[model samples]
Target: MSNSQFSEERFQQAPVVGILRGVDHATLDRIIPIYINAGFSTIEITMNTEGATNMIQKLSEEYPQLNVGAGTVCDMDDLEEALKYGAQFIVTPITNEAIIRKCKSLNIPVFPGALTPTEIYKAWTAGATAVKVFPSSQFGIGYIKDVMAPLNKIPLLPTGGVTLENIADFFQAGVTGVGMGSSLFPKQFLKEGFEQQLFDHLKAVKSAYESVFQTA
Candidate 1:
């Protein structure tokens, strides 16, 4: 897939990256449509997930409208596998300069995870499209605000602990976007076949996002 397929403008329009981790293929088949229909534009399948590359290729072909990406890419092999399988974007849980440089060389959008101010700045200087403030839960919203106080130019995509209630708060704290997993796609809802409830949940997230960015 061409790097051009990952549109920064589109992502900025609805800056929520739906994370699919450890979800089976059958479940993916059911919920992908719901996710898209609920107004999400970006989704990532973790590389550690079983059959992740295949799922990435399948989703890329099936849902061309959604910006499909690879997450949890820890090494060069993981990065190569992700790119080979048609990942439009790449997300790493740790800041790796080589990976960031490779993605930048390919013109692919890369979000490298970093916790401390030093790591975040290093990731940004290394050509990361955005620095993913992972485990944002541990430090909370105030941490993000503090991080942005000095590094305001670096785009930050906070992952983890992002919920419907505080999704807007994260944005208000100066996050370019957020990555959500269990909080956004509860396994219980999927197991119980609560598709409508899940849909409503996603809609609420979208509404919450718009509430901050005024995309409504």
Candidate 2:
């Protein structure tokens, strides 16, 4: 197993990391394979998603080829739970030096959130696999591009507000990858009446991403 230390060699090959935020056990059972089938080798189930740790353990056990990561992990307890659940990577909405060091102690890759150059650099020096530029919608892709100019050595993952139309724009602006939420997963999927629409959204987002980021 590659484990979630997110080694450079493995991460390079993993172009997209699917951020699954609104899943339950049944939803996970249905949705995880969809990402894998769409050529996404990495999947992140946020703590906001119900049964995150249990789902992580289940999905990791079932999908040996796909690397699994935990998102919205806020504390040492979450880190410990993630490790116990066999998560391969850890993600947070904000940078926490303690979480970073704790994950390092267990050899798990930690990608913390940051909005400014100072925070990004601090996260990097703290040993994050990459820094997640959260709420990219509000910050804009250009801001991220600008941030990368001075801190080019740090790898950035832009979450929130990156869509199929602008996903490549983020890449062009310069980000290692994007972590998408509602834009990829629509409201109908959560409701009972629109399963087929969910399928369409999945294919549309995946296809659009393929068209937009062939290099990925």
Structural similarity to truth (TM-score) of each candidate: 0.96, 0.87
> For model 1, what is the alpha-carbon lDDT of residue 207?
93
lDDT of 2 by residue, 74-185 (tens): 9888877888888899999999999998777777878899888899999999988889988788988789889988999899998898887777677776678778777777
The deviation in Å at residue 4 for candidate 1 is: 7.1
Candidate 1 residues 1-81, lDDT tens each?
A: 533378777788779999999989989998999998998989999999999999999988888788999999999999999
Q: Which TM-score value belongs to model 1?
A: 0.96
RMSD each, Å: 1.6, 2.8
Say which candidate scores most in TM-score. 1
**Model 2 — which ten-residue stretch has the worst lDDT?**
1-10
Q: Whole-model lDDT for model 1 versus the true structure?
A: 0.91
Q: Each model's number of backbone clashes?
A: 0, 1
